[model samples]
Target: MTPAPRGSVRQWLAARPVAAGYILAVGSALSYGTAQFVARIAVTRVAPPLVTTAFALLFGALFLLPLGIGHFRRARRAPGKAWLFIVLAGLTAASGVAFMYSAFSLVPLVVASPLGSVYPLVAIGLTHLFLQRLERVTPRLVAGAALVVAGVVLVVVGSA
Candidate 1:
């Protein structure tokens, strides 16, 4: 099918940003989940976890470098606090991936992957702690996080 006019897509995203955000999050989740499977193979069969983590991070940075180039000006103009937070975010994300790769090397993917997916609960708590002014941690959000944890527990138990 022919693509809709370019501005139509932008207008749609602008009109329904929450829906757009969810769509983007789902896409990211799919990519992350698939990457774990591939990482399992690499960590177990091809290389040790540390080596895999390094190469994976290096390749990831390379892949994003071009996209990031366009935003360099905005990133440069960001305040010191913003830069600090950005660095923290990168370090935490890298450490999480490294730990996950280590886990994958030890356990079966069925076990490791689901346990890793519980990051949402951690994210929920952190958001509540740090972003109280920006976003409310409503009961519904807590309940959803609880459900996610419960599902992860079920998956981990069932895979045993």
Candidate 2:
């Protein structure tokens, strides 16, 4: 039997539509969940927000050193467009990780995780409002956002 072509994988992934998005969402959820748990443990011992932030940032950057180096090189080579996106992406990602770890230090994982997961609903709303012209304001998105908000409320109350 002959092996399938490499392009077939790309075609298959594109054909599935929601499968890729679902996979990405699930992966992100697991990653953030684990990170939050770790952050809680770290902050419990350290107890200083700035110290926790510094350790997390230092270790995370060390872990991604290779990628950071490559990004630096790419940014140096590319003139205008690449720097624009690189700066924006770096700022967005840095703020997000810092805030997420900070939140984990302040709240329990059950509360923080659900609150962080609500970002998807925020992204959906932003996309609908600004990026996409054809996408309609659907009841499902509204219901999903409401449910996420309710879940966050429940988590906060239970934790308290």
Candidate 3:
């Protein structure tokens, strides 16, 4: 089939939230795929899992330091009640990264990556339960969640 015109593609991207989300999702998946390969290589050289985990955490924190510093400075002026949420968010993020690295060391990427990819289903379920007033639980979301679960099952069985 002939590709859609460039202007039509641009218009669709501009108009559709789902389209934008899909683009970001693809980009993130590609980066994560590359990261898993790099993690595998790093683990071969570094005997300890913490060594690779520390390096990844340190560099990621360093890269985000400027934004963190700016936010801190702003918070200092008008210290908001959101500080608790911010701290929790940081902890949650750090924990996820550490666990992901630890899992990478223990399991092959084929298994670890699929396990991690199941997070979206978890998120969808949580949102449906907690934020039901904001987001209606529709058939489409249920179908997507089912597909994610099915994909995870396939990945786990195949990896085994």
Candidate 4:
């Protein structure tokens, strides 16, 4: 098919930014999911899980360090407790990633991968407990969370 004119293409994208945004969001999710599968595959070939985890963390930090400098400067003046909490979060994330890597090495990806995604449920619970003011719980939201948990349960049980 002949290509649409460049101006027409730009107009089309601008006219439907919501659609474009959704496509971009899905694309990002697709890329991250593929990375997880690739990580699972890589761990199978490489014996050391921590090495892969360390390298992945190092590379991600190095790549994003520059972009975060502005935020770092802003955060420096925030309350000291906030900085401590951020440090705790960083430690928690690193521990979680390393454990996930180790889990991928020990268990089937089908198991580790789906169970790893249970964080959404955890997030919902945590938000309800700690961030109640930020994220109010509603019937619809509860129903949606229930559906997601049910789906995960089905997948886990079916795979067994």
Provide TM-scores for the models.
0.90, 0.68, 0.74, 0.78
* Cα lDDT of model 4 by residue, 62-115, tens digit: 988998887876888899899898999999888887888899898888877787
lDDT of 2 by residue, 1-160 (tens): 2343577756755766687688678987787677778777877666665577777778887988886785676568788986797789778877776777777777777777777777777778877888778677688878978888898889888888
What lDDT does candidate 3 reach at residue 76? 72
Candidate 1 or 2, higher lDDT? 1
- Highest TM-score against the true fold, candidate: 1
Each model's lDDT comes to: 0.91, 0.75, 0.78, 0.82
lDDT of 2: 0.75
TM-score: which is higher, 1 or 4?
1
- Better model by TM-score: candidate 2 vs candidate 3: 3
Stretches off by above 4 angstroms in model 1 are: 1-3, 6-12
Listed per candidate, the RMSD to the true structure in angstroms reads 2.4, 4.4, 4.8, 4.7
Minimal lDDT window, size 10, model 3: 1-10
Residues 1-160, model 1: lDDT tens digits: 3344557776877777897798789999899989999999999999999999999999999999997899999999999999999999999999999999999999999999889888888888998999999989999989988898899889989988
Put the candidates in lDDT order, highest first: 1, 4, 3, 2
Instruction: Give the best candidate by lDDT.
Output: 1
Q: How many residue pairs in model 2 have overlapping backbones?
A: 0
Q: What is the lDDT of residue 77 in candidate 1?
A: 96
Clashing pairs in 2: none
